[model samples]
Target chain A: MSTPIYNRVALIGLGLIAGSMAWAMKRGGVAGEIVGYARSEETRDTVRKLGFCDRVEDSAAAACEGADLVVLAVPVGAMGGVAQEIAPVLADGCTVTDVGSVKRDVIDHVAPHLPDNVHFVPAHPLAGTEHSGPNAGFAELFDNKWTIIVPVPGADRDAVARLTSFWQALGANTDEMDPEHHDLVLAVTSHTPHLIAYTMVGVADDLGRVTDSEVIKYSAAGFRDFTRIAASDPTMWRDVFLTNKDATLEILGRFTEELFALQRAIRTGDGDHLFDYFTRTRAIRRGIIEAGQDTDAPDFGRAQKK
Target chain B: MSTPIYNRVALIGLGLIAGSMAWAMKRGGVAGEIVGYARSEETRDTVRKLGFCDRVEDSAAAACEGADLVVLAVPVGAMGGVAQEIAPVLADGCTVTDVGSVKRDVIDHVAPHLPDNVHFVPAHPLAGTEHSGPNAGFAELFDNKWTIIVPVPGADRDAVARLTSFWQALGANTDEMDPEHHDLVLAVTSHTPHLIAYTMVGVADDLGRVTDSEVIKYSAAGFRDFTRIAASDPTMWRDVFLTNKDATLEILGRFTEELFALQRAIRTGDGDHLFDYFTRTRAIRRGIIEAGQDTDAPDFGRAQKK
Candidate 1:
């Protein structure tokens, strides 16, 4: 009913999040034309075949032409290069944003390459899956999820408000945060947890104490929980660790301190200590479930399997 | 078919695993009569309400009377006490077995108290739920799972074979192991991982950094995976850590060593290290899924939501 927010919207990398955004944009009728580009020729061809974009461009600069909004959806490590490549062609009045998990580095990397006319709004949709690539995107992925925006202070208020409304139309709850706090909170909530999962699964795989057969066959108990997270896109996680180094390292340090105390309790045959720790952790889980982020199912799939 | 394997089977505790065993026994017609007992009056009443047994007795000695297979399914911390309580009343030629997680301690606790005419076979059924108590039990919980038995040397071969058949009828694949090795293997595969999960959740809760609301809202990402695991029964986990102290501490030490190395990588902005670790873990998840223990979906959910 209302005018489309952007005349042309460009996606620099048509991976899972980018492709999903394309679908969401089309379903919402939010953009006049959606343009996409990917690093690989095969990926570009695949996005074209999937029809996730109105036009598939081979270069970031090509995609940026005539775009009033450009979203850099590549791994964070690639954001700087993409911004540099697209800055020259970016249309006047266009807004540049990113879907990177880490915020401070993304802002640092992209803001310098952008023209004064382009408003750089760094955002994280706080939604994903273990699956990657163009074909994995879905329209509802961002529905009811949080999208945090980190806009430079005193920057274009109208652009910020427009992006907020756009994410709302995509079914996301939007909030503004300073880039540092965003990175710190996400470190505790996402990055540290992901790294722990990857480490534990790696330890098991390297030990060879339990054959892969045993780990898999008996995984339903608790190990399977880690595997899902460990299966996330490796490249994205690598960039995240590289960029959010301080906060992630600080959380990991805190986590290890707690773990060491637990190990000491176990070593000393301290039943009450173990009991107290286990009991405390249960309350947190109950709170999480009560808050509706999780199901009350005893194990992840037990109810369904039973 | 042939006379039921046991004329009367006694279950010392009727939690998830024990209740499932009773239902599985009845479903497969493996026992002529199943007698169950619980420590507390409330649990006994709940067991009676659930109709998981042919008869409920208030005391272990009374329940084991004339029982041909007396099963101790109490917490690992209570195995010795329960075994001692029932040894005098257990029928001659009865096969006394346990369904505890740790085998060496179970053997040490239960084997010495048993009469010569009665056989003590320490068994660990690698199946369960985060839920405990009689109401949480279901018939098929053990279906297609594993049950590992650690029989003492010179134990009755016939008794061992009969116990093997019983678990097989309950829909588990049974394997024999040296109790010490079994404890050590499980220490790495199950106990240590559970402790780590609990510790991580506890750390997050204590920091209060993620905020309870944010945790549950964004929990569908990776934190919810830890929540399911951390939700496991406190008493059972407490007993596991106390009883399997040496193996558990050993594995915990190894895990911490690896974890610290990872922390250092994060602190140093080592993207390559993080990427390599994450990539290797993903391969392990693939192996587990191929082995039929896990599904590709996160938390093994039926549908991949978002």
Candidate 2:
């Protein structure tokens, strides 16, 4: 194992991302001592039993004490409160970062509370499963995934580089993006897609004519993928939509406009239009496969039910 | 192996479903001989090389001659033509079925063309991957998957029973539904979902602000699943939308209405509404897993990229 990059690393919330980060850090030896804190006592107990963290602190402040790196791993809505809670105990010159899905709102909520002595860098690791909670994490979650680091303007260059190296050592490829751009990119790639999925699943569930069993039974046709996406942590997704409102709404608007056009084409029996639009989207799937963002395996490599 | 369900099986249009049925038939000894035909010479040649079929015929009629079971495994729009072409050659008392996505449309297009001597049972195996073509088929594709059998009014009981047994031997659970209900259920579960995915992927591709590389590199977050759904066969999807116009459009209307409500929630900062909606959708996913329609495995058990 490589030498520890941070003498002490504190994770303020014990959810999927943080738990995975702790396991990854332990696997990589990227942190000398990993301290974890969760708002729920049950979560803390679960983490302690899991043994991925070196220590489970009772409070966020206690977890942050003398830590060289502090990670805010709470919901985007809770980032500011966690930041305020842990700020006073963070060691001077320690780098503070967040794992929120939306970056701009996180910076807005988190940056003001952090002390001037600390380096605040916001990062989002664009990787997760439909599962959540403390037990949902694995060391390999972030392997070969992209972790976009959104550094505040005029931030310490050394701190940024160190955080990048830290993520790299934890098995992620790191890139720097401005917070606004990061939010917009994630709006297109993550937030809006998730909202659309949730909407579709909700629509299916609300339909009185189509029984719930029918929707669930026939889901493998296409709806199961939407169900998987919609099943992601509700609180996390709520916070995501609340915080990333502007970008998510903007992308949703575009999505609806395009959807309406396709809906019209279907109504009008415009076979050529529907065919061309569908044919163009296949190129994008090909690009995703070629970029190694997803496996080319049929059905996302899902095991056949037998 | 069990007794053969049919003496000879003719598969019209040797694509994914037909090729898979050929393999599954071979695996279970469901048919004495499997004869395949495709409109394209390339597909027939590929199926011959794949060795999934006992014989590859140049024409649909030749393939249907003397066959006790004939499957119209073409696009929804093409089903009528194939049925008409094979009607004259189909043996007396032969049972004919289809693997089309839309049931009512296939029935309207194909039923009138079939001779009274043969049974026209429309069956749709609610199983497939984004991949298509002859090479995409596997024997396990239908294992433990549901196949909805839509029998025409006055369909011969013996023929229906034999066809259901044939599907069961090919590794599918069979259920019977009327054409109209099957169309409506599939519109909610599959047709509208595919259209929405295609529209969303098209919208992402159309956005100039979000570079293609950006959308692709970060797709693992959620957009990749949309890409997979959108990447499905263009011709098949186009025909599906055109033929199942009313039901798909009805579902699309409901989808857009639900989407607008959620969009309003996001814009109005209605976190509780968003949270409740998201939470409700999670139960359907749980039902799907419990029903054995999908795996509880994280991320659908996708293999981690190293």
Candidate 3:
């Protein structure tokens, strides 16, 4: 085990990412004193019981006192509130970061509230599952995942490097991008895809044409993949779209246009056109698999009823 | 090993499902011989070299001549044509079944063409991977997966029973459903979801505003899951959309309406509505996992670096 990376670390949420961060820090010995603070007493109690932190506090300010690192792990919409509450009590030279999906809004919302001596660096750990809450966290969840760090102009170098080291200790490969670029990239890669999944699942449910039982029974066909995606925590996703509206809508527009073309190909029976369109996308999957981003399993292999 | 279920079994398509079927059959000794046929010489050559079949024939008709079980393993679009070409040569009293995804259209197209003496059963082994071609198959692909059989009216009961038993021998649990219901169920469970996935991926591809690398590299965010579904065989999926039009279109319409509501909630910053909508969907995922349908791993754990 290595020495803790920070003298004191503050986690401002008790959900999946926050809990997982605490677990990773403890497992890696990447921080000296692990402190967790949630807005709820129940969550504080759970964090204490779950042993996610050496100390659990009900207020963000309480957790931030004397802390060298603070991670705001709440929904995107709550980052502003969290940053404000902790700014007053933040230890001198402390660095602030977040695990929000979209980066621009988080930077804009949280940066203004931080004290001059403290640094605010926006980050998105391209990780997590549909499951949420402290119990949903596991120490290994961050292993080999991408961690995008979006540094605002004039952000302190020492602050950035410290945060980078913290994530590196969690077994993440780190990349840096402009906060706006991060949002746009995620809008296409994460936000729109999830929205489309949610929309399609909702559509299937509302159709009322196929009995719900049939959908559930035959989910292995393909719909189950979307459900897996659609099953993601709604609050996190809802916050994503809300904060990254411009980018989300932009991707949505492009998606609708392409969908129309494919729809035309299907309607007109243009087999070659449809085939080529489908064929091009395969390279990306191959790349992902090669990059070790996904398993090559057919969508729902294990659950397939024999 | 179990006694061979058939003296010879001929698989007509050497794609992932068919290749897997051959591997499973050969490994289990469910058939003394597994012959394969493909229109493309390249595919036939690959199948032969892969050693999944005893012989790879150039023509579907030539492949089924002595084969006791003729499995039509082609795309749904080619099922009718393949059936027409092979029907005359299939051994009299031979049990004929298909591993097509859509049942009603397949039943409508293939049943009439098959000779009266040939027992026709429309069966779909709900097993597959996004990967296609002979090399992509594995012997264990169908293990624990459901195989749905939609037999024609007054079809040979013994033949249907035997076919179901054959699928069972290959490690699939078999059930029978009405063809129309099968189509409807698949539309909700598979077809519509695939369409949406294709649409979303296409949309990301068309983003003149966002670079392709951004979409692909950052895909760990959630977009990669849709791409996996989108990267499926275009010819197969196009035919799926065409054959399952009504159900798919109906589901698409419902999906669009729900999307509109979601858009409204995002525009209005109705966090409550977004939270509720997002939260309600969570139950379905829990139900699926509880029913042993999906892994609790987040989005199949796609976000992990690999």
Best by TM-score: 2
Poorest stretch of ten by lDDT in candidate 3 chain B: B297-306
lDDT of 1 at A156: 94
Question: Per-candidate TM-score, first chain only?
Answer: 0.95, 0.98, 0.97
Interface RMSD of each: 2.2, 1.1, 2.4
lDDT of 3 at A61: 85
Which of the predicted structures, 1 or 3, would earn the higher DockQ when compared with the native? 1
Greater-lDDT candidate between 1 and 2: 2
Model 2 segments more than 4 A misplaced? A303-306, B303-306
Off by over 4 Å in 3: A297-306, B299-306
The per-residue C-alpha lDDT of model 1 at residue B145 equals: 76
Clash list (residue pairs), candidate 1: none
**Model 1: per-residue Cα lDDT at residue A146:** 81
Give me the displacement of residue B3 in model 1, in angstroms.
7.5
Instruction: List DockQ, one per candidate, in order.
Output: 0.59, 0.83, 0.56
Residue-level lDDT of model 3, residues A158-258, one tens digit each, is: 88988898899997888899977888888778888888777766666665666555566566667777777788877788788889998887777677777
By lDDT, the best candidate is: 2
Model 1 lDDT tens row, B1-306: 545888899999988888999998988889999999998999999888889799999899999999989999989889999988887887888888999988888788888888888888889888877788898877777777778988899978888999999999988888888888788778766887798888778877877556766665666556767877888889999998888888888777778778888878777777788778888888767876786565565335422442
Model 1 residue B207 lDDT score: 73
For each candidate in the order shown, give its overall lDDT on alpha carbons. Answer: 0.83, 0.91, 0.80
lDDT by residue for model 1 over A36-130, one digit each (tens)?
A: 99999999999989998999988889998989889999999899999999999988888999999999999888899888988888889987878
